[model samples]
Target: MSAAFSFNRIVAIGLWVVGGGTALFLIAPILAIIPLSFNAEPFFTYPMPGLSLRWYNEFFSSEVWKLALRNSIIVAVFATLLSTVLGTLAAIGLSQSDCPARATLTAILISPMIVPVVVAAVGIYYAFAAVGLLNSLTGLVLAHTVLGAPFVVVTVTAALSGFDQNLMRAAASLGAGPVEAVLRVMLPLIAPGVASGALFAFVTSFDEVVVALFIAGSEERTLPRQMWSGVRETLSPTIAAVAALLIVFSTLFLATIQWLQGRAELQKTHREE
Candidate 1:
C-alpha cells in the first residue's frame, strides 16, 4: 500500500525481466542449432528442407566419430576418478585446523581454473612434449585432470563449509581412526557434493577442446576436437548434430547435480526435524 514499497517492487520486477531476457538471448542460438541438426539437408540453416535422422546415424556409425567418442569417454572417466580422489583429500586436509599453508596450497591446486585455457594448453603441450607424452591418451587424461580437479576441490570445500569438526573428534573418541572417521562419517554426508564434483569433472573433460587440440594425438582425438575439425575441414549438418548431442549431455549433468543437491537438502532437513 505504501509508495516506497511499490517502487521497490517495480525495481525487483524490472531486474528479473532483464535477467531473464539476457539468459534467453544467450541460449537462443544454441536452441536454434538443435532444430537445424535434424534438417534433411546437409546444410545448417533456418527452416527445414524436411526432417531426417541421417546426421545422427552418421555420428553413431562413422568410425572417426566412434573413435573420438571412445577417446573422450576414456579420458573423462580416468580424469574424473583421479580428480575426485585428489580433490576430496585436499579439501578434507584444507578443512582441518592444523593444515599448513592451506591458502597457498589451494591456490596452486586450483590455478588451472584461474589460468586461461590457451595458456594452460601451451604450457601443458610443452611439458608433455618434453616427457614424450605428446599425442597420447595418458597425456590427454593428465591434461584434463588438471582442469577438472579444481571443480572437485571447490565443491568439496563448500560441502565441508558447514561440517562440524567436533563430529570427527567424537568419532575418534569412539575408537574410529582418522581414515575410518572420514570414510564412515564424513563421506556419507558429503557424497552428494563429491558426485556433483565428479560429474562436473567428467563434463569438463568430455567437452574440452583447446587442450585436446594441443596435446591429443590423431589417435586420441576427442568429440570436441573432432567437431572442431569438422567445422574447419567440411562444415556440415553433422557438426550441428554433434553440438546438439553435447548440449543434451551437458543438460543431463546439470540435472543430475540438481537432483543430488535436492536429495542432500532433503536429508539435511529430515535430520534437523
Candidate 2:
C-alpha cells in the first residue's frame, strides 16, 4: 500500500510540473512583452535603459489608437449583446430532447469556430460586399456575432445540463407563458452561464482581427487591426503597450469567467441538494 501511494504521489507531482511548464512556455512571449511596454528606450531590447509609461501615454494620446479603441468597444459590445441573445435562445432550443436534427443544427451553428479564420474572412468579405456591408461597422459587428455565438451556445448548453427542465413545467403549471417562464425562472437560474457566455463573446469580438480586417473601414479599425497595421508599418513600442493592456484585460476577463463558473457550480449544488 505504501509503495502504491508513493507511486501515485510521484505521478501527481510529475503531472503538475509538466502542466505548469507547458503553461509557462505558452505564455512566455506574452510575459516578455509586458516589460517592453514599460521600456523608456522606445525600442524592444533587453537591458532597458529605464522603465517608463511613455508608450502607454502614446497609446492613449494618439488619435489613431483612440479611434481603434472606440471601435473595438463598440463592435465588441454590440456583438456580445446580439450573440448572447441568439446563442442563449439557440442553446435552450437545442437542449429540448425533441428538437429536430439536433446534431446537424449544432454543427451548423458552431461552424464559424470549426472553419479556418481566413476562409471565414474571405467568405464574409465577399458576402458582405454583395450587400454593400463591406467597410461598415454593421458588417464587423454581424461578422463577430457569428464567430462569438458558438461560444455562448456551448457555455449555455453546459449550464443547461445541470438545469432542471421540470422548473419550466412548474412555471407553466403556475399559469406562466413560455416567454414569461424563461424570463422569470430559467434565466435567473442560468444567469451565471449567460453572463459567462456574454464575456466570452465580448472577448472573441474584441480580439478578432481577420474578420475585422475584411469588414472594417478606416473609421471602424479595431484595436487588434490597429496593432496589426502598426506591426507592418511602424513597429513601435506603443504596440507593446497595447499588448500589455490586452494581457491585463484578458487576465481580468478570465478571472471573471472562473468566478462565474464557481458560482454556477454552487448553484447547481444547491439545486441538487
Candidate 3:
C-alpha cells in the first residue's frame, strides 16, 4: 500500500509540474503583450514608466485604425456565418454516418487547421488575383471561412458527443421532416454549441494576419494587419490599446459561451427528466 501511494504521488507531482510549465510557456507572450501595451515609452520596451491610456486614445482617434477595425469586424462576421453554416451541417452529417471512413472524412474537413497559413495564403492569393478576387472583401471572407471552419467543426463535434440522436428520431416520427427536426429539436439543444463555435470562428478571422497580409493589402486591411504594419513601421502604444480592447472582447465572449453552455446542459437535463 505504501509503495502504490508513493508511486501515485510521484505521478501527480510530475503532472503538476508539466502542466504548470506548459501553461506558463503558452501564456507568457500574451502576458508580455499586455504590459508592453501600457508602457509609456515609444518603443516596445519595459521599465514600468507608469501606465497611460494615451496609446489607446491615439488608436481610437486614428482614422486608419478605425477603418481597419471596421474591416476586421465585417470579415469576421461574414466568415463566422459561413463557417457556422458549413461546419454545423458537416458535423451533423458526420455524426449521422455509420461509415468506416468517418475518421478520414473528419481529418479532411479539418486539414485547414494543420496546413501552414503561409502556404495556403500564397496559393489563395494567386488564385484570387487571377480570378479578380484579390484586394476584395469576398476573397478575404472565403479565405477566413476556410481557416475558421475547423474551430467550428471541433466545438460542434464535442457538443454533439453529448447529444441523443433518438430525440431527433422522435421529432421526425411526430411528422417532422429533417429540416424541421433539426431546427425545432436538434438546434435548440445544440444552438449553444453552435453559438460558441461561431464566436471562435469570429475570433479566428478577426485575429488572422497571415492570410490577410498576403491576399488583401490596404483594401481589405484587418485590425491585425494594421497592427502588423504599425509594428513594422514604428513602435506605438496605440497597438497596445487595440490589444487591450481585443483581450477584453475575447474575455467577454468566453464568459458568454460558458453561461450559455451551462444553461444548455440544464435544459437538456430537464428534457431528459
Candidate 4:
C-alpha cells in the first residue's frame, strides 16, 4: 500500500510538471508580444525600451482598426447566435438513440472542424461566388457559422451525456410542450454548456483569418484579416497592441469556460447527492 501511494504521488508530480511546461511553451510567444506592445521603442527587438501606451492609443484612434473591430464583432455575434441554435438542436436530436443515420449526420455536421480550413475556405469561396455572396457580410457570417457549429455541437453533446431523458418525459406528462420542456428543464440543466459553446463559437469566428481572407472584401475586413495585412505590408507596434488585446480576450474566455464547467460540476454533484 505504501509503495502504491508513493508511485501515485510521483506520477501526479510528473504530470503537473509536464502540464506546466507545456502551458508555458504555448503561452511564451503571447507573453513576449504583450510586453513589447507597451515598448516605447519603434522596433520589435528586445532589451529595455521605455514603456508607453502609444501603440494601444494608435489602435483605438485609427479608422482602419476601428472598422475591423466593428466587422469582427458583427460577424462573431451573428455566427455565435446561428451556430448555437442550430448546433444545440442538432445535438439534442442526435442524442436520441432512435435518431436515423445519427452517426453519418454527426460526421457531416462536424466535417467543417475536421476538414482543413484552407480547403473549406476555397470551397466556400467558389460556392458563394456562384451565388453572389462572395465579398459580402452574409457570406462571412455563413462561413463562420459553419466553422463554429461543431464546437457548439460537441460542447452541448457532452453536457447531455448521462443526462436523464426521463425528466424530459416527465415534463411532457405534466402537459408541457416540447419547446416548454426544453426551455424549462433541459436548458437550465445545460445552461453552462450552451454558454460555453456560444463563447467558443464567438471566439472561433472572431479569430478566424483564412476564410475571411478568401471571402471578405476590403470593406468587410475583420480584425484578424486587418492584422494579417498589417503584418505583411507594414511592421508596426499597433499589431502588437492588437495581439495583446486578443490574448486578453482569449484568457477571459478560457477563465469563463473553466468557471462555467466548475459550476456545472457542482450542480451535478448536488443533484446526485
Candidate 5:
C-alpha cells in the first residue's frame, strides 16, 4: 500500500508540473507584451529605461485607433445579438427528440468552426462581393454572426442536456402556448447558457481578423485589423498597448463566464438535491 501510494503521488506531481509548464508557455507572450506596453523609450527591449503610459494615451487619442475600436464594438454587438437569437433557436430545435437529420444539421451549423479561417474568408469575400456587401459594416456583422453562432448552439445544447422537458408539458397543460412555455419556463432555466453563448459570440466576433481582412474595407477596420496593419506598417508600442487592453478585457469577460458557469452548476446541484 505504501509503495502504491508513493507511485501515485509522483504521477500526480508530474502531471501538475506538466500542466503548469504548458499553461506558462501559452501565456508567456501575453505576459511579455503587457509590461512592454508601458515602456517609456518606445521600443521592444529588456531593461526598460522607465515605465510610461504614452502608448496607451496614443491608442486612445489616435483617430485611427478610435475608429477601429468603434467599428469593433459595433460589429461585435450586432453579431452577438444575431448569433445569440439564431443559435438559441437552433439549439432548442436540435434538442427536440423527434428532430430529423440531427447529426447532419449539427455538422452543417458548426462547419464555420471546423473550416479553416482563410478558406471561409475567401468564400465569404466572393459571395459577399456578388451581393455588393464587400467593404460594408453590414457584411462584416453578418459574416461574424456566421462564425459566432456555432458557439451559442454548442453552449445552449449543453445547457439543455440538464433541462427537464416535462416542464414544457406542464406549462402546456396549464394552457400555455409553445412560445409561452419556452419563454416562461425553458428560457429562465437556460438563461446562463444563453448568456455564456452570447459572450463567446461577442469574443469571437471581436477577435476575428481574417474575415475582416477579406470582407471589410478601410472604413470598417476593426481593432484586430488595425493591429495587423500596425505590425506591417509602423510596428509601434501602441499596438502593444492595444494588446494589453485587450488582454484585460478578455480576462474580465472570461471571469464573468466562469462565474455564470459556477452559478449554473450550483443551481443544477440544488435542483438535484
Candidate 6:
C-alpha cells in the first residue's frame, strides 16, 4: 500500500510539472513582446540596447494613435452602459421567471461568445448595411454591445444567484414599490458584480477588432483598427508598444474584477455567518 501511494504521488507531481511547463511555453512568446516594446532600436530585434519610453511618447503624441484611442474610449463607454443595463435586466427577469425554459433563454442570451467573430461580423455587416448603419460609430456600438452583453450576463447572473428573493418579496409587502426596492436594495447589493461586469464589457468592446473591421469606417476607426493597419503597412516596433499597453491595461482590468469578486465573497460570508 505504501509503495502504491508513493507511485501515485510521483505521477501527480510529474503531471503538475508537465502542465506548468506547457502553460509557460504557451505564454512565453506573448510575454516576450513586453520587453520588445521597450527596445531602443526602431526594429523588433533585441540585444544589449537600453530601454526607452520613446515609443510610449510616440503613441501619445501621434495624431493617428490619439484619434484611435478617442474612438476606442467612446465605444467602450457606450457599449458598457448598454450591456450592463440589458444584462442586469435579463438576469433579474430570468431569475424571477418560473418558466422551465430559463436555461435555454440564458443560453440564447449568452450565445455571442460561442459564435465565431467572423461569422457574426459578416451577419452584422450585411444587416447594418441594409439599415444604413454600416461604417457608423452607432452601428459599431450596437454590434459591440451585443457581443459584450454575454459577458455582462454571465457575471451579473453569478451575483444574482446569491440574491435573496425573500428580501424582494418583503420589500414589496412593505411600502416599497418594485423600482424603489430595486434602486434601494437590489442595486446596492449587486453593485460590485455590476461594476465588474461593466469593466469586462468595456474591455470586450475596446479590444474587439473583427466586428469593428467590418462595421467601422475611417471615421470610426478604433485603436485595434489602427494597430492592424500599422501591421499591414510596416513592421515597426510601434505596434509592439501598443500591444504592451493593451496587456498592461487588460491585467489591471482583470485585477479589478478579482478585487470586486473577493469583496462580494467576503460580504456573502459575513451575511451567512
What value does the lDDT take at residue 166 in candidate 1?
Answer: 82
**What digit string (tens of lDDT, one per residue) describes model 6 on residues 55-171?**
888998999899999999999999999999998888878878575689899899998999999999999999999999988889989999999888888888888788887888899
Q: Which stretches of candidate 5 lie over 4 Å from their true place?
A: 1-10
Q: Report the lDDT of model 4 for residue 62.
A: 98
Measured against the true structure, the TM-scores of the candidates, in listed sequence, are 0.93, 0.96, 0.85, 0.94, 0.96, 0.91
* C-alpha RMSD of each candidate structure in angstroms: 2.0, 1.4, 3.2, 2.0, 1.4, 2.3
lDDT per residue for candidate 5 within 108-221, as digits (tens), equals: 999999999999999999999999999999999999999999999999998998898999999999999999999999999999999999999999999999999999999999
Q: Which window of 10 residues has the lowest lDDT sum in candidate 3?
A: 40-49
Q: List where candidate 1 sits over 4 angstroms from the true fold.
A: 2-13, 265-273
| C-alpha lDDT of residue 71 in model 4 | 98
Q: Give one digit per residue, the lDDT tens place, for model 2 in 16-118.
A: 9999999999999989999999999878999999999999999999999999999999999999999999999999999999999999999999999899999
What lDDT score belongs to each candidate, Candidate 1 first? 0.92, 0.96, 0.87, 0.94, 0.96, 0.90
Local lDDT at 35 for model 5: 92
Better of 3 and 5 by lDDT: 5
- In candidate 6, which residue ranges exceed 4 Å CA deviation? 1-20
Worst 10-residue lDDT window, candidate 1: 264-273
For model 5, name the residue pairs that clash: none
Task: Identify the runs in model 4 with alpha carbons over 4 angstroms from their true place.
Answer: 1-18
Which is better, 2 or 3, measured by TM-score? Answer: 2
> What CA RMSD would candidate 3 show?
3.2
Error of 5 at 158 (Å): 0.6
Pick by TM-score: 1 or 3, better one = 1
Candidate 2's TM-score: 0.96
